[model samples]
Target: MSKYLISIIGPTAIGKTALSIKLAQHFNTEIISADSRQFFKEMQIGTAAPTQAELAQAKHHFIHHKSVQDQYNVGAFERDALLCLDELFKNHNIVIMVGGSGLYVDAVTKGLDDFPDVDESIRKTLNQDLETKGLEHLQKQLEMLDPKSYGTIAIDNPHRVIRALEICIGTGKPYSSYLNKKNTNRPFKTITIGLHAERAIIYDRINQRVDMMVEEGLIDEVKALLPYQHLNALNTVGYKELFNYFSGAWTLDFAISEIKKNSRRFAKRQLTWFKKQEEAIWFDYLTPVDAIIKKVHSTINAEN
Candidate 1:
């Protein structure tokens, strides 16, 4: 009678979507996506969001559920995801959650760290700094103020950098100081499944995926969203690089190359974060889906 949350986590382009759909089908359950980039309805191609066909194979929640203009954050996602899980547990004993966004996953599984409410003016000033001084300036400020967060966070993303800097400035403490302080209790048991691969293979896969995205109209997608490129949701790996190209700051080839390089770096950071989950069960990226499902069943049985 116990409910279970089967969480699938890994780096980008590692086939988490495919595996998650299979697992959901096997368990006869629904899926919750934790990828923050894919939440924006306009970022389908660049984010490599689940294709309509893949979505049709399994019921999924939280994909393309919000607009890029929406000011959504991990805190809001935590509240929303927990509510979704509460409703899903009433119908099925098991539900699957999948994505590569480490922070979002931790928010649902562990709980978010509590911080004092910062003044809106602090955030406004940070945004002003970002506009006038550029992201590199803010990033350097964070590196000086909170080196730990600078190393771990998506430093290339302006939104993440600004968020950290705002906390440091607003509270007069290192942003990293607020992490890992809260332990939330949930109703259901959680079983985390991590997918991994060799560094060379992971990099190659990311490069190929980025190339495919370009071939699949990633540039066009970015062009369509040019009007809203200033939004936080648009400040992501695939979109930001192309924005530079559109601005004539870089050649198209260079922009595509940056996307791959940045994506590879993002994957490295993702692996570093997910590997810290000492309780997670990890599998090779190419491992048989049946083997993973069997492991999940055994874990559930053992827990019961």
Candidate 2:
């Protein structure tokens, strides 16, 4: 029999973990989590990492493996996850990897773009502009410099947009121009299965999950990590919304509302991102999960 890697991905709070656990138990194999936030042990509640029961069900790797104080990015994640897979593959041919984080998934399966380095002064200039003139000013600059990126980037998210503009201005090359490169080859075969549902259903689930997170002490989680709020890892959706509240930029109600709104928007973008991959096989989250699992089983059997 041939072995392979099964990657399950979907929007936040769309039941990716439950499905992954089921598959891991079925294959009797370990799971490698690609959740970027869950890697930080300090971010347990906010990241919705696996519970104790799920952890005990199957051996897992990469969950709660880092700290918010550490500077871990996709480059580091790619190195670590591939290394874990290398050792796991020695005994078992099939390993399950699952997460909603698009960049990490792409990094492991397709590899990251060879982004050119920018001078420190370039980022410093942009940071100064952000503080003095605000992100709107830098956003307008990015739109003018790289319209393609401007169309795809989250305008409200200043850091990413500015990063793109910084590269464009510093390297004299459009950010999108570099993205046209090809994917790097991987040693293992990747079978990507995406979970999806109707927009209303997915959005409602996300909102409900946010409300549950609040009831489950999400505010306290953010409070505990406030000292590390400036870290890139803490810049995620759940934490950032509450950070604005802490900074007095918004009221508690407003912050909660923004969390739901941003989370919905993020899920939409996730769907859009995953939809672009022609190889991804999607299944509705509500329908009989066994059907999809059987399909996966058949597909794997055929490939084997």
- Top candidate by TM-score: 1
lDDT tens digits, residue span 226-283, model 2: 8998787787888899999999999999999999998888887777667777888888
Off by over 4 Å in 1: 118-124
Listed in order, each prediction's TM-score against the native is 0.95, 0.92
Give the per-residue lDDT of model 1 (tens digit) for 17-136: 999999999999999999998898899999999999999999999999999888899999999999999999999999999999999999999999898888889889988998899989
Q: Candidate 2: which pairs clash?
A: none
Task: Tell me the whole-model lDDT of each prediction, alpha carbons only.
Answer: 0.92, 0.85
Model 1 CA lDDT for position 195: 93
TM-score of 2: 0.92
- Per-candidate RMSD, Å: 1.5, 2.1
